[model samples]
Target: MDIRPIRTDRLSDKIVNQMIQMMREGNLKSGDKLPNEGMLAEQFGVSRGILREALTQLQAQGYIRRKPKDGTYIQDDIQSMLMNDSVNELLKKTTYSDLLDFRETLELKMVEKVIERASDEEIEEIIEGLGVADNEKVQHDMDHYFHYKLAQASKNIFFMNFIDTYYDLITEIAVKSNRDQVRRNQIAEEHLAIAKAISARDKEAAKNAVLHHMKMVDKTVIGEEGK
Candidate 1:
């Protein structure tokens, strides 16, 4: 247990990163109890409050679980935590176009899986979800819900979590891009195209629809940024 001292700005974040690194390197294993807060604070050369903040973050992110009347322990599901953290960090650094590109990749793959794995009922559920956004008025929440249902139709846990993690960020970009009725209608129509293609079981068409939609999103977001 060679926990290094953290003497940097954002001390809590540094501590969190070091703990994650330790877990990755097998220096920390699942079910291993964390050293007492006082000892950890002393080892890291940080105040107890800072170390507590880092522990709080770790608990929130599912990297560790804190038990009342007990100690903090490493969570068993380390991979999911790592994936979530990685996705969040990547999104923070991404520009509009970068996010659009990453989204396009994930969405295209997701729809393909949906086409392969979704039940007829699941497909209909997706179409029904799209109907929520079918109105002439643009509802950001409805739009986000439709895409989230689309991700669910993929029947992949990882895809579902990935979408869940980024949904808010995606919605923010959409809010910036959807400046008027025309753009909103265009986005609605794009979702309709994707739903229709998937319902018809046309994988190629679904892929094309998603690609077109992503390009439109990219253009809209970039255009908004230029303003």
Candidate 2:
């Protein structure tokens, strides 16, 4: 706990790393209020300027948020991952086929993590997300949200951000390449099953559910393009 006397040169970065460590160690979980700036400055034995600078970086990284009078707290949602400059390069080179393939990879992984840590309330949101099936357009949007929320529940901000930025193209390709109503229904069912397994906290079952869903996407959706 005594992380003092580290050095003066890297004070800001060291403080940032310390806070990130707190988050990783479950000391500062999401929604947890950070120690007040004055308190943190006292604890870290750093100047207030150094502490504020570290907090600024954390806020920009989406690791925490600042409220007007409530002070800083951990963020509930992930930040956008499209900040990497290479995203533009990837987009320029990416085809519809590539987008479909990428989605299969991302969603499957997201589902696997959701199975590991999602709570009952989170699972219920996902289950309700699947019930938006009255209309095709609405169903598709719901399906996208379902996947996005599942990723968010994984506690992996990078994955959530990546999907949010690119999911539109993914849905466009899915709708165009696989117009079969039965197949759409199957996808919906798979999402529900994944949520069920996560709610049950059966890790292996959750993994299997996600992998099975990805296989379906591979066979029916991505398979249509022959890539």
Scored by lDDT, the top model is 1
Q: Model 1: what TM-score?
A: 0.79
| Per-residue alpha-carbon lDDT of candidate 1 for residues 112-134, written as tens digits (9 for 90 to 100) | 98889889998888777654333
Error of 2 at 53 (Å): 30
lDDT of 2 by residue, 1-227 (tens): 86767546588998888877766667777778878899989999999998999999989977889998889988764222213424644754787557656766776677778776777788888787676355556666766788788888999976776676665556665665446677777878888888888888777787788778877866765565664
**lDDT of model 2, residue 89:** 45
Error of 1 at 61 (Å): 4.0
Best by TM-score: 1
Q: After superposition, which runs of candidate 1 have C-alpha atoms over 4 Å from their true positions?
A: 1-17, 35-57, 68-70, 132-138
| Root-mean-square deviation of candidate 1 | 5.9
Q: Distance (Å) between predicted and true CA of 39, model 1? A: 5.7
